[model samples]
Target: MNTPSQLLPPPPRPLLLLILDGFGERKERENNAVHLAHTPNLDSLFARYPSTLLGASGPDVGLPTGQIGNSEVGHLTIGAGRVMHTDICRIDQAITNGSFANSPVLQNLLHQAHNVHRELHIFGLVSDGKVHSALEHLFFLIERAASQAVAVVVHAFLDGRDVPPKSALKYIQALENKLEGKGRIGSISGRYYAMDRDHRWQRIHQAYQAIVHGQGMRFPTAIQGIKASYDTGKTDEFVEPFVVGTYQGVQAEGIGFHFNFRPDRARQLTEALAIQPFNRFPRTPLEHPPFPHYACMTTYDASFGLPIVFPKENPTDIFPEVIARHGLQQLRCAETEKYAHVTYFFNGGREKHFEREERILIPSPTGISTYDQQPAMSAPLIADAVIHAIESDRYDFILANFANPDMVGHTGILQAAIAAVESVDQAIGSIVNAAQAKNGAVIITSDHGNCELMLDAETGQPHTAHTLNPVPFLYIPIPTSHPLPPFRTGGKLCDIAPTLLTILGIEQPPIMTGLSLFVSS
Candidate 1:
């Protein structure tokens, strides 16, 4: 067998890997924000550099076939350098194989609630987004609870970002029909208040008050609560917390199950409900009754000390860990909104930073309800930080995420998305300029697609959800020293880590199954 170092040719030193979040490639011009944006820098790079489109959605990123990719799975696949099974895939497999119904974890929780004559509370986003939580998964849990004769109450978190803006009522009606008096909708709130991961304690406080104490705007039914929010010109995502009909709050000894498998947005609320002496934010006290016993569908945070029904088996020997083992100095930078993607998910779901790895988190735009108002959304600040790092020459490898395209794309505003794309293009131009000054190479790519397809082709309605389109991957060797190897086509997001390793003169670990795009067949 050949030694590890002999597997690939040597590469340029001090590389910069830039991830343009939610940027994708599409041929269609109409309603494509990326196509409409004045992105001369990106246009020039695509024309001049060695570039190829990489598959980012569905089975390409290890999600179920036909499922849209999310930042979590995208970054994880890039780091793992292989098609790793996602939480949704694993859960779906379990459900299909009947293991989910027979899970001891689920059975125990149901039995506990039934024996104690207490309510079983299920909380999660109500959508078919397949990014955070799926409505079908919620339905499965409810059906199981009803089978056990357990009293089930759903604290529905409305979703508009991943679906149509005014579609909450339709989902609510479907849920109501599914319940059919077997269970009840206890509370309704927008994900903006309930699923905040940005340390927006005030938002979390409102959700907590509404879900735990039944202390928000009251409505007799879930449908009325959503319709009232629509009357106020608010979409599903911004619906204020409200209680449904005389539903009492989660009581002591109650069993709580969080159905959101993805961990990022679920972390804060899980912490608030599970941790004792909860000090993350000021919380209203429950004087006599203690907090309910809680379990998550997957591990949100291992430190939270809660049981997980389907715990994630994190991948080993991922890209970052290999770099750390080689004693290479690395830097990870992103705005607050996507900091976890670059660090935690890119590190294979581990929050701990490796040796010789440095992280910088620029504060994302604050005090803004939506990113459309500030479409730039701190990309300039992130670019400045990245350019400064390139100049310092302190890191052998640097990675930064520009969150503009993805965050603003979710707002479903075409003009704002164009601005967001333009902003990232400008930032990429600056970073490339700085890298060239240092004789360094830069690889530009994206986690997934969101801003590319802005409007549905048939309906002409806003297409706020992630698309199945492929993302662009461009490799630029600063100053054009010598002829570089041609990149192979038909690549996937999993091919990125091995490609980066090949370009950095690092050996691809045997655990990684993805081939480097730089290698010819």
Candidate 2:
């Protein structure tokens, strides 16, 4: 084998570096980045070259699908050049395999538990949706905490938006099983406690029964998931109507809190927003050919089974037969490259309705163009933030988060999200322009992916609203005079800072889990 000195490449040309938020995603002709509107600069970039599906295969897809990439790991690899999983998984594996005993953050937490007789609170999502936080890893953390003689108080952020409704029971059972009996391999000798919005859901279900009972639905039978419509048993076909409103409802107001739709009809809106990846649902027996009405939806502990709204928008005046004739043409007849999605939900009859064909409604138009928004900050805010960073001569690296595509997409409001993406595209131009001025290289990429999806191939409708796509890894080169490290490509997020140090001729401590993208040892 060749020695370390002979293996690495020479340093790169001197240059500045830029990282565009969510810039690593791709553009597509159908239902993709092109959906946004007025992205002149981004359009040119796409026209000149082809974009690839980034991090398509690997451990990043749920179990590192070896198919998709996520943000944390992607950035780690891009910055460091060589790494696996992310901080979450890395910490978890250390604990699982017994190496985390030495990690300072973990070690401190563990030892502190022994000294303080109080309980430790573990607050996070409680689902395998793994989009943000992972449940399996959380369990390991809980196990480790208990092993150190610490009483645990877990406040689980139930992920009804991701997993199925009322599925908290599954995770609860799992945790309960893990914490069963002390003195096990886990190391601690104390019992752990778990509780989530106690006595809340029961009252809501009761309220629904009471409200629907008056309408002659016969107790609005309780059930979850798809059961043929003919099946009398009630199914939890859910959607979350309000974001802060719903989350607030569960916290301030107890269960059985009722909201009225009709003057005398106090019906239960299953204000349960399904986690995306399944936003465009079963081909409904509706009127119009389906169009993406909303892209994002959220569900909370109290909002479960509350019939909020599916599409969460008003119905169209046109009929389905008319819409069907123009639906496919509408999908393909786009002239402009930039498109945007906007879905709005109102407090009325239903969040959405299946039109004549298959389209769903997100919300009324009022929500999209509220005069309250800042034209100055519309899309330029992203760029301004980056430029401000450079002007201030702050840190060499800036990791900022722009939430248009990811946040809005979850609402299933394809149109609105498209608009947000257009804004982001404009922002990308600003940052890239700044970096180019400084002889910088912009390595744009994403953590995980969204907005680049279709219905699961077999289902033929819409896939679950999820960031399952493989994002892009783009490198915008810049000419420079300062000494630079050799460029290392196809790395993870953990590698970025280390790589930056390497590129700038700075030294990185071995404690860091990242490697230099420019030079590798």
Candidate 3:
């Protein structure tokens, strides 16, 4: 039942794409934060508005079978309105087929290193988290570099968010085992320093000092440093940066290479390493004598790459860029961590700045690593921004992401997650009110599941990882207008873009590849 474009009249209102991060719908109420919380606004929306379940994990989000949904793939699918074969699939395939060693990207970087007579610096998260680069893939790259007679310096960032908290030692030891006598393994730090989305140059500076100057709290060994931090109640992701070997003032001087396919994270570290004559760090007057030549596994941001200069023209165009080309004005609003998810990932891994599109980034609360302390987070601020935009009627569409449930849920704190969901519910109510007042429609969905499935089924302990749960897709109709149409079926998140575009009287681009949820007359 595809709705024909001719039968559709001019939309009576604008549309809002409200993404409640990790707010999935689950029936298991025991320890389920969303179920326990007083989400009156969300409940009201569900009862009144037309809604359906969205398949958010594994194949639904376009990952390999059994792969849990993460922010990178979730947002990419949402904005693309299509199933893009994500980096997770490609990397997994590469590892399985033994093609990673012979990859063109790896070969090109190796060739560049050989031609330039410089050591190849390989940097990335050494974890089994499928969302980011995998430890197996990193090992293969290192082993291949050695075979190719290339001098390689491996900079491994710690991971605790995706994996079990404070499990950095396991990954570090594994890498050490692989790199024993093969290559130099040095400059170990937390993912927080390397994967900063906001302008947290201070964190990046700490990482740089550890990598280039070998300056940090002196640790006799890698294991000791990790254990010391763990003993002090610091998770691996926030542990102070430390060098692997003895701090002998050895800098990794060579062409740098890092494998981060996801566009949303880790740009700050790459920029700090790549940029030459760097003096941005406040505490230390630092300058890289040689501008680090580097290449990512895939160009994360096609619109803008390293050296930190805004490009006059984007190197490539993504979904938002294409939408802008069609004369659609879009407003993207999110907090620091997910700012890239909206701007960079939503735009198809390109950092394009369109005159018509505006981005609003509310800083995630600083000085606190865990989100449970500030359970409400910046939901109200983001909601206010969206409300103001809807009131102004300046943009054709507004996309907002409330990161409370996801952030707080990851902490495995039941009470905080409950409060986080409630906070999001309150914000949703405000956005809906503002939209309805201005004759606008609201479409709310989530990236993936988290707080809804809080406890592990067997263990009954708090589950910290994203779950393979379906999220709610609630559509509140334009104020005072007869319903446009009911969705044909419960669809994937990728279907969201076409649905929104159709509602806004915009043509669905062929590249979108998603079937419209509505049926034709």
Candidate 4:
């Protein structure tokens, strides 16, 4: 096989990769945010540049055959240049094979709770969405605790973004049925409060108060809390924190376990619960004793000093590592909402930066209850950062994530999603103009699909969940003296890193099985 340098000419300087989050394509134009929005720049780019549809979901992005893609796996696959089995997939397999029940970390926590006669607190987002946390995993953990005769108390974090809006009741019922009156629900709150990644201490404190102090609105049952929220015109995501009947808070000596495998959202809460000298917010002191034993399904951060049932195997030879090895400078920029995706997940789950790598995080809009209210969230700001980096010529490669479509799309508001697509399109136009002035090429792609398919086919309700749709990959070589090769069609997200490396005249690493998308003669 011809090497990358042999196939391509010398690398172009100041390459910009603009990831339009949740941007996807489908034939149905009705209720499709991208189709409904006026995206002149994106339309012209597709017409003028080398564009093709790339598989972003399901097996193409290392998810199960029918499972939709998520930002974590999407960015991880893009950087790894190969299929990466996600934590959820591995945990599911372990459960099916009966290995999860025998995991040492889980066994130890259960034994501690059982032997000490302390309540075992199982806390995490309760959903079947398979994005952040899965309901089946919660059930498995609860069942395992029950077998050991350890009392289980569930702190349910409601999920409305990953699943349908107001679908928390179904999950609550499922959890109740699974318990069979064995374990009781302790407290309930929306993931917005419990799974915040943006260091929103106020929101985190609300969750902490509900879980640790049982200090929230009182409800006779989980169903009543959710029903009251619905009566007040609130969806699952905005459900106010509430405590269930006669529930005491998590005891200091209690064993706590968080089942959410994804680290980005789970990290803050875990730190608050498990870490000492907690100074992020004024943590209410526990009366009994803080978690005598605290563990998680997967490793969130090694610094958290918590035992993990399934520790992450960080990928080697990823995009950033290769770039640093070549002595090239690169910048990863995104708004706070997706800062991790552009850096952490994009670097194959490694939190540390490469030698020549720089990062910029634009704060996402604050004080908004939902992103739909501010549809054009931080895209213009992120685009400005990328443009400045490109114009400065300080970095060989620049990558920024436009978080409008995915973030606003989750709100299931059609008008807001349409506005978000337009905002990203405007931002891209500005960035592309700046790149062209500097003779820099711009590559546009998306991690997954969310805004494209707005309405559910059967229910016709707003489809808030991500779709199994293919995303667009457009490569625009701007005013270059050298002729660029045509991009190959039928590629996947994993092929992106190899394609970038091939364009930069860098050899593809042996560990990267994904083929480059550039057509070779």
- Between candidates 3 and 4, which one is better according to TM-score? 4
- Over 4 Å off, model 4: 1-9, 286-289, 481-483
TM-score each candidate: 0.96, 0.45, 0.88, 0.96
lDDT digits (tens) for residues 1-521 of candidate 3: 54544444466456788898998888978889999999788887888867888888888877867767888778888888888777667676777777776666667777877776666777888777667776766777787777777777787788776666666787888887887767776677887787766677888888878876778776777888789888997777778788876644333445777775554465667666665545566423344532256667655554334521111122233456566887878899999868878887787665666759999999898878678999999988998888988888888778899999998998888999999999998999898988988878888999998888766667454577788888888878776645456666668988887877777667777777876666676
Between 1 and 3, whose TM-score is larger? 1
Please, what's the RMSD in Å of model 3? 3.8
- For candidate 2, give the lDDT of residue 470: 52
Q: Candidate 2, TM-score vs. the true structure?
A: 0.45
The Cα local distance difference test for each model comes to 0.87, 0.37, 0.75, 0.88
User: Which residue pairs in model 4 clash with each other?
Assistant: 252-289, 252-290
Estimate candidate 4's alpha-carbon lDDT, on a 0 to 1 scale.
0.88
The residue ranges of model 3 lying beyond 4 angstroms of the native Cα positions read 1-10, 92-105, 108-119, 247-249, 282-291, 300-328, 455-462, 481-485, 488-490, 519-521
For all candidates, the clash counts are 0, 104, 6, 2
Segments of candidate 1 deviating more than 4 angstroms: 1-10, 286-290, 519-521
Can you write out model 1's per-residue Cα lDDT over 132-196, one digit (the tens) per residue? 99887899998888889986889999988888777888888999988886788999989999999
